[model samples]
Target: MKDAAFGALLAIQFLTRLPVPLACPWTPATRRWAARAYPLVGLLVGTLVAIAGSLLQGLLPPPLLALALLSLWVALTGGLHLDGLMDLADALGSNTPLERRWAIMKDAQVGSFAVLALVFHLAWKGALLWALLAAGASPWWLVPVIVLGRLGAVGLLVAVPAARGEGLAHAWQQSLTRRDLVLAAVIPLALSAWVPGGAWLALGLAAFIIVYGLAVRRAFGGINGDIVGAAIEGGELWLLLIAWSWWSFAMA
Candidate 1:
């Protein structure tokens, strides 16, 4: 249990670039468990982001607060998913075949399509978050959304096969076990229970994971680190969009 907890915290540190007071000794087994614990990192990220946004509530307008929250989120994660989003966008936009698309993703240069996609994705998220805040969605809602989004992404890691021969996804691809999946499922469910309207949030998470699973099967042939990142960003955006829409309609 200590190893598992440390592994989880290590994963959080890796994903969020957050400093920890203590460091876990790295081992192959611990590294494997770290991959399994990656999703839980979002719980920590969400808590910090919520605290920041809530604190800024009185000082900043809704749009500015949303931007600040979004910026903090990207900074916390070191823009990992944003890079994936860009790479995926560039690959999909190319006229080349699947083999070439994979090659394109390997290139370090960001293409026009990638730039456009990043802009749209970030803009959409910022606008949605602002709209949610303006609609008077409670800060409590953000917590579950963030936590569930990451868990939903983790579900993808377990459910799909890696699309590439190498990368972080490939490195720990074999780490996932039946017990790991069970633990992942349980953690999010338990955490969701703490939030207001959490049942709906959990339902949305289930739906997102289900849909992403199907999409991964059809689109990417399987999952890679890129797809996992895409799932996390996409899930968060989808949840925020739904929440904003609901709030807007309710206000109407």
Candidate 2:
């Protein structure tokens, strides 16, 4: 029980701007439980955002509310995953050799591709969120997609070989094992039974796994922390797009 509690705290500490009054010791057990707690971390993020969005929905217009929510999301995460997305984008956009690309990923500076990617990524998310709000969708509707998005990271981290010998991605890969996946997947599976269009969302997540997993393996030699973060952001967008696509079709 204590392990699980600390695992949850460690996850929050790593993934969000949540304050933990105690220092979490990193160990094999923490890693195992942390991997298992991935979905819960996402759930905590989603629920907080959802509740805040719900409360503010009526007080502001859709566009303003969407921006506020988006801003809050960034604040909560400290743009951790988005930074990974931009780093991966810079590496891919450079169109350089493997060695050069790896160097770019390691470089602390942002490049043109990173800027472009961040712009487009934010635009897309904001637009879709505005659309969702304008369409009278409840903020609660996003919970499952958020869960699946973070869960996607766990899948990639487990399935893909670490691209480099050092840094956050490789270290995370060191801790997680195949057995950790059992607990990681439990929440999203249960959510499938609760959220409308959820079973299909599960299929959507599977597709994300196959597509990004293979893409990273082929393009970058394997996955890293940036790739996992990129996967989380991309996974969320993909899941959101899926939900909207199906909903539009249903209305049509």
Best candidate, TM-score: 2
Model 1: residues with Cα > 4 Å off, grouped in runs: 20-28, 249-252
Q: Model 1: per-residue lDDT, tens digit, 57-153?
A: 8799898898999999899989888888888889889967878888887789999999999999999999988888988876556776777777776
Candidate 2, residue 69: the lDDT equals 86
Expressed as tens digits, the lDDT of each residue in 13-103 for candidate 2 is 8789988899888887887788789899889989999999989988999999989988888788899999999999999999999999999
TM-score against native, each model: 0.89, 0.96
TM-score, candidate number 2: 0.96
Q: Tell me the deviation in Å of residue 5 in model 1.
A: 3.5
Computed on alpha carbons, the lDDT of every model, listed in order, comes to 0.78, 0.87
Question: All predictions: root-mean-square deviation over Cα?
Answer: 2.3, 1.2
